[model samples]
Target: MSRLRSLSPATDEVLGEYEIAGPEAVLAAVARARAAASWWADQPRKGHLLRWKREIAGRSDELAELIAAETGKPRGDALLEIMLAVEHLDWAARHAAKILGRRRVGSGMLAADQGAALEYRPLGVVGVIGPWNYPVYTPLGSVSYALAAGNAVVFKPSEFTPGVGQWLADAWSAAVPSQPVLQVVLGAGETGAALATSGVDKVAFTGSAATARKVMAACARTLTPIVVEGGGKDAMIVAADADLDAAARAAVFGGFGNAGQTCAGVERVYCVRGVYDDFLARVTALTKEVTRDAYGPMTIPTQAEVVRSHIKDALSAGGRAVVGGAESIQEPFVSPVVLAEVPADSRAVTEETFGPVLVVNPVGDLDEAVRLANATSYGLAASIFSADQAAARAVARRLRTGAVSINGVLGFAGIPALPFGGVGDSGFGRIHGADGLREFSRAQSVTWRRFAAPIDLMRLDRNPSALERARKLFRLRHAR
Candidate 1:
């Protein structure tokens, strides 16, 4: 068996080594999950999930350290990610029954003598392919919801963060040792591909859109359903009436946090021309305060080069670096870089630069801002900052992204009730709230006859009068 090593992107220290799960191992894991699915689905999943949540919470610090070590995010940021993940777990556990339980359905007037009901049933097994950035939070967005909805999961975490994934699975095993309801399979893209086509009922993948296509293709052969949360080139818009200070602060944090590894992190900003100069000044000053060491090192080392290319391209296109320029990229770490006056068509504006960089451009008005924000093929998440609540909300409605934060940045991600995902190149399907619980399960509809119909419409021999009566009823109901 091939072994995979998890190393800290910051210090290059070996975090842990795991045996890579090949195609055979992935199939075995799927089989195990299939075996556990029925038993897990029948049990009181809330209790199991709560116990697992408690286990994670009890060792939150240890888990945070492991996350930091594996992902090169600051310890504090890792802790925050853990805390948010725990909150989502708790929410899913408490709300699953209410959301997925069988409920009476209204039978139409024509079927008044019948009783109908609907419920969501767990898929046999789910294969979750998680991303390296936000390894804990992003995967658990699917894992916690899937488990709460009573599906057994075989998770294949990103090779870069295998230790963190193993920790999560170990915590589950400790919490509920009766069955291996949740299992982690370690490896790189091949293992992920194996899991995708391993006959799991569904696959939940989070990563680049290009990689998502490969996962989709593998699952296509088996006709397995998949939910993809592809990364986004998200944006932020500042209106003329917006709070410059608040917007600038949010931009700095949203753009540079986690070294800009966040999929929904602010990559572009459109400022209304009236406040463009002041907003630019405020953003530049705040960005300057963010030193190279403020955030953790680039979790994925090669992403540094991508960041460099974007800055270089923007500069060559006549854009000015208001803050740290190309010099900000130091091997493992990239300091905050904010570019102003970048051309609308620059790769720095159009493509997703998954590093600590932001492109700021001036727009004539909020309408132009909205137009530019929606112009991108990606519609993941976005932010609109304005002091006027109605105006902000109106602008928010016009943005084509999946979720929008009004007067703030990324607030929707923290709210477990809100469904998260995107349209267009950002991918489809949601991973939280009611939609998430239902995403991992299939809906079953049932109808049973309560009493016989007076017309006896089922009999062909005596259907003449019944047909006339039915036609009368249909005309009365449909002739709006």
Candidate 2:
């Protein structure tokens, strides 16, 4: 058995240790969860939903503290996770009947005598491999919706934030009080792999694209369905007629919040040349005001090197740090840094640094800005700041991504009504709203005969004469 990995803040030198469940143990627990899922799913949907909400709400403070300690986020930010998650759970519960309930469908002419309907059924057991950053918000997007859709989930939390995962699992079970529909498997990559191949119904993974590929391959061995919410190099656009102050705040917070470990965090910015200088000054000032608290360390310690490399590459490529340059780093927490006049081909522009770094580039106009924003392999969430609603929505429609915010930043994720996920390399499948509910449930179609067939159309024992009679009747109706 592989030993459990230690967890530590990006700023702290000493590592805190926790024992990881071995692959065998993880599989055994998953098997038990699969067996228990049948009984859990049998419970009344409304009852289950009420219980989940009660659990989340009752222990709100404890959950918030656990989230903050595990991810090194501020208390307010941690509370945002709980708030957003609760909203999603509430919305999903209230709307699941409309989204997942059986609906009648028109049958084709050939089968008009039969009534057909479609419904969404839960997958047997879902494997969720969560990321360390935003341990509460990120994974809850998957776990909550999956549970609402009636699937049992075995969540493998990030090694750095196993305690948060355990807390959630324990709380959920406390509410349910009977079945362990939601279980936590604490381990590193190997345990995740075991879960992927553990004959599970499906896998919902959120992480780097490189790791997503590995997850896909592993699930393929078991022929299990999977949804990948891989990382993104998302971009933000500032139009000439946009709100400069709002755009600056959005950019700074979107880029540097959570120490910039967000998969959908703003990594690149494209601003119109007309307000480029003014926008740059405002953003630079905001960046100066933004400081990392010593308590808020790097959520993922290993990512420090990647952050350093991205900054070094940008500087080497002649990019100037208009606001924060090489002087930002102390140890673990990275001071928010803004890079300006960076080349489009630079690493910071093309790759996901997953750090508190932003690369701002000047564009000729709205057209050029849209082009620059859509120039990455990722099609995750994006932001467009413009006063022209028509123009903003038009540009947003053209961009290939899961969600887009017009005249606002990161507001799409806040809305519990809109679907959240990405296209292209950012990985497919949603984790919020209606899209999130559908992700965990498989579409099931059913048909019932309203009346007995006049002829033996479906009977394998039918003779050629019956087929000829049917053909003659069809030809007589449309011979003209």
Candidate 3:
């Protein structure tokens, strides 16, 4: 570790910080996790899951504090994250038996006498590289599910918030007391790269799309299976007859909450022309009411320039700033920025502005809204505010994304039953619900003989005429 550097919420000045992990440290931790995986996988699912849940329940407050301190998110939000993690853990534990249990499968007619079955098995040791935005919830989407699927985890938290990862590992160690099934390898890019290249069974990564590409390439070198959960340029569309007040509230909460550091946060808004003005007014008012505290600074300092560039592009492209202008950025904390009349060509319209900025565009109708919403390279989660369930489902099916919310923003992520992930440049594989649980494990097919083998069709002693007669009889009976 290197010397600590202090960081400011504004002005990009340093306040306080610590060094990230190195390659050696990451490798050592991963090695330990690999050694412990067998013991964890050998444990009964019922007992291991109970222990995991008890650990989370016992350390709820501590986990929230650690998450808040490391991510600079509000305590309430941190608590919400922990709650979601616990919920997923509970769901995964209870449902793992059914979701991964072995069941019979019908073989083709050629192998009718033989019975086949498929099952899900643990993937030994799994590596997770988590983002700093939602330290507890996001990683646990993989961590809890992986544990339930019987894999030991070697988690590498983002360099921006390594402390959070360390805290989680510490708590697990304290709770289990049997073996350190969960471990943390804290560091920077080198540490993450080390984990990706290590001999882990699989890697579950969540971060920027560019970084996801690099991670994928590194894993490719070792032919290791991976699940890439890159960031999203999520959008929320307001229908012509939509409730402006409700849509505005959701847009503000979804876009600017947690300093707009959410992967599924609202980056773009396509409002129906009939209620565009009303929606914008309400959203602007909501944006103004949000206040930034000293605790929640920009967790990723380098993102400051990225935010600035998006704002500049929107302004230059003839977009009017409804709330935060370029000057509104106050360093570690940024006031909410709302842009209207933004050109479709602007970066704010096409790219993932992972900040407190929103671009609101008007469409003639729901069809136009759908077209504009699906224009981006990244397609993660999306919101369609409409009272008509049939219309919402129709629009959702045509949107070409993973999860779609009918009357809410990012509701699919909150629903433990729904699979949460993205498509296209946003990356593939889900991180929540049943899909998430299986991502950390491999499907194992098994067959056990219940009866003696039938004829000796493969034996050299079998006559060619006998096989020919059987084949002709089978073909004659099956012919249409």
Candidate 4:
């Protein structure tokens, strides 16, 4: 078997080695999950899922340490990510039954003599392809919800964070020792592709749009359904009547938090002319105070060059680096880079840099700000700051994204009830909340006759008069 090694991006220290699961191993894991899915789905999953959640919560510190070491994120940030994951797990476990349980539906007038009902049934097995940036929180968005909806899961964590995925699977096994309801398959892109075509009922992928396309293609071979949480070039909009201090703080944190590795993190900002200078100054001062120790290194080494290229491109295009420049990228670690007056068309503004960089641009008014913010092909999420709550909500409605924050940034992600995903190039399908639970399940509808109809329209020999009556009734009821 081929072996894969996990390393600390911060120090290049070897963390642990895992045996890569090729196509056969991935198929074996999926088969076990398939066998387990039948038994697991029949049981009351709420208790089992809650117990698993508790187990994860109990060892959160240990898991956070593993996540930090593998992904090169600060321990505190890792803990925060775990905390949010636990909250979401709790919500999914507690609410899955109510959201997916069978419910009676009213029969329409045409079928008045029939009774109707609807329910969501789990897909037998789910294959999850997770990302390296958010080793824990992001993947759990799918894993927890899939398990709660009563589906067995075979998870393939990112090559850089396979340890975290194994840890989660081990916790689930310990929580429910009787069955292999959740399992981990370790490897890189090949392993993920194997799982995608491994006959799983559905695949939930979290990664770049380019990779998402490959996964989609692989799954298409088996006609397997998929939900993709592709990364985003999210933006933050500052209105003239916004709170400069709060807006600036939010922009800085949203842009640079998690070393700016977040899919929904703010990467672009459009400030109305009224408060552009003040907002820019506040952001610059706050960004300067952000020391190198505030966040960890870029988890992926190649990402440094991408960040550098964006900064260099923006600078060459008449953008000014008010905080740090391309020089800030020292191998694994990238210091905060705040660019002002960056052209709206620059790669730094239009694409997902996925680094500790922010591009702030001044707009003529709120309309221009909205236009610029929505101009991007990637519509994942956006943040709007305004004193007028109604106007802020109106702006939120106008934006073409999956989620929005009125005065804050990335606030929609924390609320478990709100479905999270992107639109356009950012990818499709939702995870989190009611939508998340249903994403892993297929709806089953059933109907039966409660009584015999007065006129049997189906009887061909004597249906002429009945059909004429039916047409007259339809015209009376539906025609104007």
Candidate 5:
């Protein structure tokens, strides 16, 4: 049997190999999930999986090591991602029923004699294509919510991190024990596409925008509904009155955390001209002191070339690297590089450079900062730093993104109540909280005819006088 090797990103060491799933095997997994979905949905209210959520939380250390070995991230970073995933899983289990339960609705005047209500029904099966960066957190965004909403999930983790994916599967059976509620399919992109077109009820994908289009096209064959969480060229704005030290720390984490391979990771910054020099000085000093050549490697091998090219493009177009230069993108690992005065149209600024790279520019004022921030095709996430809480919130609200943090970056993702997704090229649909629970369920409207109207308007033998009176009453009540 052919096997897929799970190699370490930093050392290129083979961690383990798993049997690769062909198209037939992929379909079989979905079939099994389809068969078990009804029983799983019938077991109890979907929210009863709270016990399973706890089980996942309990084994964090074991899973964290697997994450580090597979994805080449530091163990501490892997643990952090696992803890955050546990938080989201807990929230989903606790709130799914409230978010997806049926509720009564008011009937309009035309249907005054009718009683109306609505229900959110679970889709039988869901296909999830998860990304490699922050593997645990990204997959949990869809997997936890899908399970909470009463759907069985067939997860196709990134080929780079199949070991992490298998770890999740092991935890799933320990919690449930009776049914294969969550299944893992190991392979490359073909496996993911197979799941999408394999007659699943819905597909939730997280990855680059370029691949999102391909997933959409595959799902189109079966007309399966899909929710894509694509890449972003996220930005942060620093106001003149902002705390320089705090903003610098935020830039370091937002731009370089997880080897800068995050979907909502910060890639650019717009600073108020009054504090531009001070902010740059603080950022440069912090970047040099804290950044490391071995922080972590790019999970995907091909991403290093992309990062290197983006660096060269920026430097060749008159941008200056105040911190790391063009050679910063070493094989396997990409060192932190901060570019200054990069042109707006340069590929470094316009595209999603999934590396530890930051492009900071000076703006005349808050207006200019907001304008420059909104100038991207991506609307995934953003951050704003300012002394005035009111002013910072106001600017944060003005930027076009799915979520924004005041004086921080990526903070909204940790809060389970916020809807996480984006518009435009960043892709559409949502995950997390009430919106996510509803995303995996379908709405069903139920109405009952309580009684007949005063006049028999639908009868063929209706009297002219009664019809005239009904018209007059409707006109008097509605037209006035």
Candidate 6:
């Protein structure tokens, strides 16, 4: 039997070997989920799914340990991810019915005799492909919302973090043990592709832009709608009037947290020329002080090579590291590195390094800051640090990203009700709040004739007189 291996990134220990679900197994899993979807969907108010969310909250530590072992993140970081995932799950379960419920709408004059209603229906089954960096929180962002919205889910977690996926599925089954509301197929890209084309109602993929393209193309073959969350080349813009201390802290935490493997982590910092020196000093000091002992190993082995390549390219392009040099990157781990004067065209600036690296560049003005920030192909999430609320709002409004944190980094992602996703290369479709609920459901507009009208436009009885009156009324009301 073919198996997927899970290794501990921190100690290079073998965590466990998991069965690899092939195309046939994936199709069978989806078929089981399809059969169970209707049963699960028919339950009112998600059949105590809210309680299941509470279960996750209660036992999050156990799950977090599992996450830590598989992904090699610290226990603290793993718990944080689980905590947020539970919060989102609870929010989704509580709000899905209200968000997708039937709502009355006003009938326009043309349909004055008819009663109009709008409602959303479940999309049956959803296939989710999640990344390894944020295995618990990121995947649950889609899985929880989909389950709450009344769709059964078939989740394909990153091969590096398959244990987290198993925990999620096992937890859900324990909560609602009646059926297979959510199923997981474990393997690499082939397994994911199989799930994508296995006739699921929709696919929500979270990973690299290149991989997203493949997933998007595969789903297209089946005419299946997909939500692509293709990671981010997220940036932080420090305006002239920004809070230097707060911005510095945010930059350090955002850039170094989770070994800078965050999809929304601050990869680039564009500072206005006025306080550029001061801001750079603060960030560099803080980044240097921040220790990597708490940071676990990089989940993906090849990712270290990518980070090294980007750093080498920046150095080759005349960029300088203020805090850490090329020596900072080692196999399975990276130390926080503060880069200064990196070329905008450098790979570290243009692409996602996904390591404990930050490239800070001085901008002549806020306009230049915004322009440089928007120059990236990715716009998943960004941060704006400014003391002036109005100015911050203005600057944040112009960033070409999905979510922006005005005063802090990753503040928007912690908000359970806000939508999370990106545009352009970062990918589209949202996965939280009302938008998230509707994303898993299909809209249905219904119109019915409540009663007889004085003159029925569709009826053949004396419709000419009514038409003449309607024309007269239009002419009188609308004509110049």
Model 2, residue 280: C-alpha shift (Å): 0.7
lDDT of 6 at 352: 87
**TM-score, candidate number 1:** 0.99
Q: What does the lDDT read for residue 115 in candidate 1?
A: 96
lDDT of 5 by residue, 297-386 (tens): 888889999998998999999999998976876688778899999999888999999889989989999999898889989999999999
Cα lDDT of candidate 6 equals 0.89
Write one digit per residue (lDDT tens) for candidate 4, span 7-78: 999898999999999999999999999999999999999899989999999999999999999988889999
Better of 1 and 6 by lDDT: 1
Candidate 5 stretches with Cα past 4 Å from truth are: 45-48, 458-466
Candidate 1: tens digits of C-alpha lDDT, residues 1-480: 899999989889887889999999999998899989989999998989999999999999999988988888888999999999999999999999999999999998888888999999999899999999999999999999999999999999999999989999999999999998999999998899899889999999999999999999999999999999888889899988899999999999999999999999899999999999999999988987888676789888789999999999999999999888999888898888999999988989999999999999999998898899988888999999988999888888888888999888889888998999999889999999999999999999999989997666666587787889988989999996
Candidate 1 Cα errors over 4 Å, as ranges: none
Tell me the whole-model lDDT of each prediction, alpha carbons only: 0.92, 0.84, 0.82, 0.93, 0.89, 0.89
Q: Which 10 residues in a row give candidate 2 its minimum summed lDDT?
A: 6-15
TM-score of 5: 0.97
Off by over 4 Å in 4: none
Residue 438 in candidate 1, Cα distance off native in Å: 0.5
- Backbone clash tally for model 6? 0
Write the number of the candidate with greater lDDT, choosing between 2 and 3. Answer: 2
* Candidate 2, 242-341: lDDT as tens digits: 9999999899888988888888768888999999999999999988888787236677767777888888899999999886666676657788889999
RMSD of 2: 2.4
Model 2 bad stretches (over 4 Å): 1-17, 454-456, 460-480
Q: Please rank every candidate by TM-score, starting with the best.
A: 4, 1, 6, 5, 2, 3
Model 2 residue 185 lDDT score: 91
